[model samples]
Target: MSGSGACEGLPGAVRVVAGVSGSPGSLTALRRAAREAARRGGELWPVIAWELPGGEFHAARSSVPPPLRERCEQLAREELLDVLDTMFGAAGPGVPLHALIARGRPGQALVQIADRDTDVLVLGAGHRGRLHRLLSPSVSHYCLTHATCPVLAVPPSPLEAHLATVCRRNSWHLRLDAGQLTEREKPRGRVRDA
Candidate 1:
């Protein structure tokens, strides 16, 4: 369903492309993209890409086991739907959310889709650890450099949220996206900066 439009009634114009891989970071990005689409009355295109091994692409379809490919496709669909369900419950957003599945490298897939049809490309700020950052380049980094549209990178939770994770261990309820930072849970007399 790369180009398939799951939701209708949206104008055929601008689109918000989000790189979703079902990771916690990607899910956070998806929520931000959905809210942006809802606010701007644009289409939310959540894209997930899968790829065959390097040696398998040139092989004929008959050469690959049918069941394996079928299972891969099924899992891809299920994961995409599950992410959607998890993000927004029974009643989805007012804006149209069209989930898309592309076939290629993740970063390349997102760049291709955005170049073709996207107003903004949004992704989560991936692993910031020294080893990971030094060893591997993230999809967000690739998109920031290559994507035609503007890229919005949402960083992971701040220190307060991290402390909450360690101290209270409560489930995440609020997300900080591209919006004002309201004093929702801050203790009295604690001054917070944006």
Candidate 2:
């Protein structure tokens, strides 16, 4: 669908802004954002946010070399392109696509881009464990509280949840039962011959 016509929000055009990080959940969010944009007859804006090794405060304290900063931005840009290519391929999403590489926290960047009241901010509702949440702030929570526009936090896909269970099992050194494996595979029609 052509987004040539103006949308209600954002003065001229309605924007469906999504946060991408190359993660499976983020990929799901990206796909959902595209659909949202198409449904609203708006543009899709996928933003990848990045920061220096030690974040903005550290960079300000130390004289970060220009090359290093440039490299960080370049990597973020490449990741954004890779995600877009993976999702839509050469055909591109039906609506207009505008990719952004922002230099800040993911939540803050997304909230800033989707500033208008009518704009929609899409994010992955990451399935983070307690330790992970302690180490890093929850982007979805940040956006939900701070965003001026509506925030759509997509839940983790079933596959992602299954993968996380497998990882946890592996980390705990738990042996998988052969019968359980077959039982799980049977439902998916991938059972193996004995």
Candidate 3:
């Protein structure tokens, strides 16, 4: 679908898709994506992903009621729009912005959009807690591995930058000491501290 209208095609030659979740990292990603789009003479497509509440499953839908489900969907849409407004501001003039809300896992939603609608995909590295990164598969990671287009996983903000650096350094040394790999082998992304 088009950014603001019917099935009409997009206005630019290139499309930059960014995933936004109302977090600082998402905001960072949105800004970076917008800039990239502008630099490349393209448009920015910001997608927000939301999942149905656990109780809304088909088996339980009758008990949950339709009104509640509709309300939940409405809330998700409003929240996503509010985030776009906050990040892009009222006039948001320079770069054309197309906002979309997809219902599914964030990574999957973004990947689908990237596969069909973009030239480059951008994402933020959310919450830099060492344990968090190690235990979970981040949206950025998912998209990096799956997106058909080029993916840009922006590094964490200044506050988390040092932590990432320390983690990378420590991991590099550990790998050498263990003799599991050679100095020529480099980790794909920032390594998390164990």
Candidate 4:
């Protein structure tokens, strides 16, 4: 959907635009955006941006089949709705929410939707390894630099980090120690540089 069209029926001039991708970090951002929207007496606009499997250059050369294109769009819409449903349930976020499924790069679509100066863009600043960063562009970094409105990059929750650590260990077939996990869970005091 067009950026302007997405806001056509939504209430409130001030918007808290959230970039959602069904990730735990993105969900955290969505929740924060909802709170911000409620506090500012504005609406929450959750946008999910998607592109073809092979990227734009590949699509340009091979003219993607119409069916495949439609399926991709459908998946994007489903993911957006699923994220909203998973986070807010039937009760909803207790704020006006306008969810959009846009076709393009995540950073660009989010920036475009949150075009107004009054709008606030919220994105997930998840932990990324060197390899991950090398493979994919950082959406949060892009938004922070490019968005005209204010940008809030929400860090992943502690639980998310723990889960990531567990997942990594599992993938690497490393032994998981309950004691180590507990130790990590304990809050740490600030340490001044020696």
- Which structure among the candidates has the greatest lDDT? 4
Across 66-148, the per-residue lDDT of candidate 3 in tens digits comes to 78757766777788778877876787827877677676778988888776544789999765577988876689888988888
Q: Candidate 1 lDDT, tens digit per residue, 7-28?
A: 3324565688888898778888
Task: Please list the C-alpha lDDT of all candidates, in the order they appear.
Answer: 0.73, 0.84, 0.74, 0.88
Displacement of residue 173 (Cα, Å) in model 1 is 26
Candidate 4, 1-194: lDDT as tens digits:
33335565354378899999999999999999999999998888899998999887789899899999999989998888889899999999998777888888999888988888899999999999999999999999999999999999998998997888899899999999888777745448876789
Cα lDDT for residue 154, candidate 1: 80
Q: Please state every model's RMSD to the true fold in angstroms.
A: 8.2, 5.7, 11.2, 5.7
Candidate 2: tens digits of C-alpha lDDT, residues 1-194 = 11212223335678998899999999999999999999999989888889999999899999999999899988888888889899999999999877788888888878877889778999999789899999999999999999999999999898897677777888999986656543643365577889
Off by over 4 Å in 2: 1-11, 168-194
Per-prediction backbone clash count: 0, 0, 0, 0
Better of 1 and 2 by TM-score: 2
- TM-score of predicted model 2? 0.84
Models 1 onward score TM values of 0.71, 0.84, 0.69, 0.87
Best-to-worst order by lDDT is 4, 2, 3, 1
Candidate 1 displacement at residue 99 in angstroms? 0.5
Query: Which whole-number lDDT from 0 to 100 does residue 31 have in model 4?
Result: 93
Worst 10 residues of 4 by lDDT: 1-10
Root mean square deviation (Cα) for candidate 4: 5.7
Error at 189, model 1, angstroms: 10
